[model samples]
Target: MIRNPSWVLRSYPSGMPTVGNWMLEDRPIPEATKGELLAKTLWLSVDPYMRGRISQAKNYATGFGVGDLMSGGGVGEVIKSESPDFKPGDIVVSDYFGWQPFTTIPASSAKLVAATDAPVEASLSFLGMPGLTAYFALLKTGDPKEGETVLISAASGGVGQIAGQIARIKGLDPVAVAGTDAKLEWCKQLGYRECVNHRTSADLVADVAAACPNGVDLFIDNTAGPIHDAAMLNLNTFGRVVVVGTVALADRFDQPDIGLRHLRKTLIARARIEGFLLDDHESEFETAKADLLSWFKQGLFETREDVIEGIEAVPYAFVRMMNGENFGKQLVKL
Candidate 1:
């Protein structure tokens, strides 16, 4: 019998999740049923969205219950199959079952990843949810125009990095704010018009304002605390703000967020602020994948995946990502 190791939620975290909150278990791998196929995980993704899942508070999606298997996006190889649609050795991606070495899922639920000229890992990162989030949010929500100033927070992260690059491709002036000098420099190399080290900048708002002399026309906010406030202050008339991920509020989502109220600024500038989720834009996934892959193939876009070996590192990777220690997309390679 195959020894299948998995990570399960031990308890709901009040704030940032600790390694203690997760428990590892080993169980015999179950066989695929009549309509199900067994998949062995090859790669597991740790993302900011998972932070919200471990909390007790009810989100748009149900929170992980105590002792429940932690689930996220995972790329796996089908080992045993009872369904004709899937054969052994087929690579697939699923969002329903993860944090486990092996999973038995319905054949219809798992998506078969086609053999691409590019790295298959790209199917899980830039050509995956993060890229889709960047595409639809920037195009449909932000509605950026040529020569418009686009400001992206958490600019070196999985989603923000792509958003800024997409903005540049659309002929917009992309300015980014990241925590470290290395991240800022990376963003600059990614073709950002300007990149600011928000952590080192003496005056973050002033820095952002100086970067965008004409003011921010499109703002994709990933960390929505001080960065969001700074973006709000510099928003021009009819500006658009797409609220993607709120890393700044990662630990404090349970409590009331007290900060500079941007209600007056929104009213004055007639700016629009809207929250975005990839699940809401499922229909646009193909379009997004096509554009991202085309750019990637043409050498017009690029991204880095910070991969660590072993499933044992999943919890630590999640925690580190929450602290903004990850320079790119955080992944666990089994």
Candidate 2:
């Protein structure tokens, strides 16, 4: 039997997780039972949302229990099957899978990934959760109109990149806010009309205001700290805010973070702010995926991925992503 190495939660993290928070353990690989398939993992995703799962605090999703096998979205090739629906060499993707070399999953639970000109890794990033998140949040929540200004936070990140591009496609002007120069440059290349350095800008409010002279009509917020506050201050009379992620609250969700109170601004602007979780829009996945794939094939959409080799790198890769050290979608290749 092949030995499968899996990353398991070693402890609940108090702050940013380290290697000490995880343990790589080996276990005997087993054959698939009836109606199941055995898969060899090829790509595993590490996202900011995973940070919330490791914490004890209540999040939009359930938290991972201590000593549980760390699981997330992954792409794999079927190595063995006991079901008629799958055969050897079939490619499949799962939103629930372990960070391991191999996994035995029920055939019905995994989805088939059709062959495409784009790399299969896209299934975990742009074409997967991140892309889906961007599509739904921008189209449904933010709802940008033609010629309107859309501002995106964490603009070089997985969902942010796609969010900006989708806004541009829908005839809105996209302005980006990023932490680093390289990330700002990436936002520029993705067709952002202006990029603000939220990390170094002396007066973030003024900086965002200058970047968006007409005021922000739509705000797609991935980080919810200073950027959100500044966006709130610059909202148009009929603006919309879609709070999709909270990277700014990483490792600090247990504590209340004080910032500008924007109630008066929302009240006067007549703006709407809503929290968006992707799972709430499962019915919209097919429509979003089709639109994203079409734009991607037409060269209007593209993605950047930061990949680390080997399953052993999952812990460090996740930490790097959580710390905003990864420039794009972060993944581990086994």
Candidate 3:
């Protein structure tokens, strides 16, 4: 009998998660049932959003409890199919694949990865949730206009990098706010109009103000903390703010985020701030994927991945990503 090695939540953490919070155990490999497909995971995504899954706070999605299998998005090869929509050897992507080498999922939950020049792992990065998040958040929520200044926080990150490039493609000026000099340099390579190392800036508000002298028209906020304050302080009239991820506040999700209130700045700028979730825009995923692929084929899209090997590294990868240590999309290759 084949055994599946899986990671299960050991205990919830009070602050930053550690490897100690997870346990690896071997279980019998599950067999695909009627209307289900079994797959061998090729790549597993470790995103900032996973922080919420282990927290006691109520998240938009159901939170994982102790003993629950650590779950996230993954790209895999279908090895056993009990559904007509999938067959052995087909590549598929699903959001529910736990931290295991093999998974049995309902056919309805899996999407067949289209054959593209890009690698199969791309289905978990730029061509997957991160790309989709960047796409709709910028175009639909941010409502970017040509020549407008769009400031993106965490600009070298998975979603942030793609968001910056897409803003540039739409003829918008993108100002990147990242943690390290290396990250800022990479943002420059991605064609951001300006880059600011948030870690080195003496006054982030001044830096952001200087970057967008004309005032920011759109703000793609991924790290909501001091960066959020700086962007709000420099927002233009009728500026749009799209709140995607709050990685800066990951450790304090259960605590109140006390900071400078943006009510005055918001009122003065008439800024429109809205939170964005990819799940809310699932109806247009196919459309977004098509557009992203088209841009990629045109050589207008570029992405980076920070990957680790083995399932045991998944927890470490997630912690590294949340710490802003990973360069791009963090993944664990099985």
**Top-TM-score candidate index:** 3
Question: Compared with the true structure, what per-residue lDDT tens digits does model 3 show for residues 106-203?
Answer: 88989999899788888888889999999999999998888999999999998999999999899999999999999999999999989988988999
Off by over 4 Å in 1: none
CA shift at 75, candidate 2, in angstroms?
0.3
lDDT of 1: 0.86
- Candidate 3, backbone clash total: 0
Question: What root-mean-square deviation over C-alphas does model 3 reach?
Answer: 1.1
- Cα lDDT listed for each candidate: 0.86, 0.88, 0.91
Candidate 1 accuracy as TM-score: 0.96
TM-score of each: 0.96, 0.96, 0.97
Say which candidate scores most in lDDT. 3
Candidates 1 and 2: which is better by lDDT? 2
lDDT (10s digit) by residue, model 2, range 218-244:
999899988999999999998999988
Residue-wise C-alpha lDDT for candidate 1, range 1-334, written one tens digit per residue: 6667889999877776778889998967867899888989888888888888888776777888899888888888999999999899999877765687888777877888877767777777898878888888888888888899999988888888898889888898999999998988999999898988888888888999999999999899898888888899999999999999888988786777789988989999999999998889888788888888889888988798889889889899888888899999888888
Q: What is the lDDT ranking, best to worst? A: 3, 2, 1
* Residue 5 lDDT, candidate 2, scale 0-100: 90
Q: Over all chains combined, what TM-score does candidate 2 have?
A: 0.96
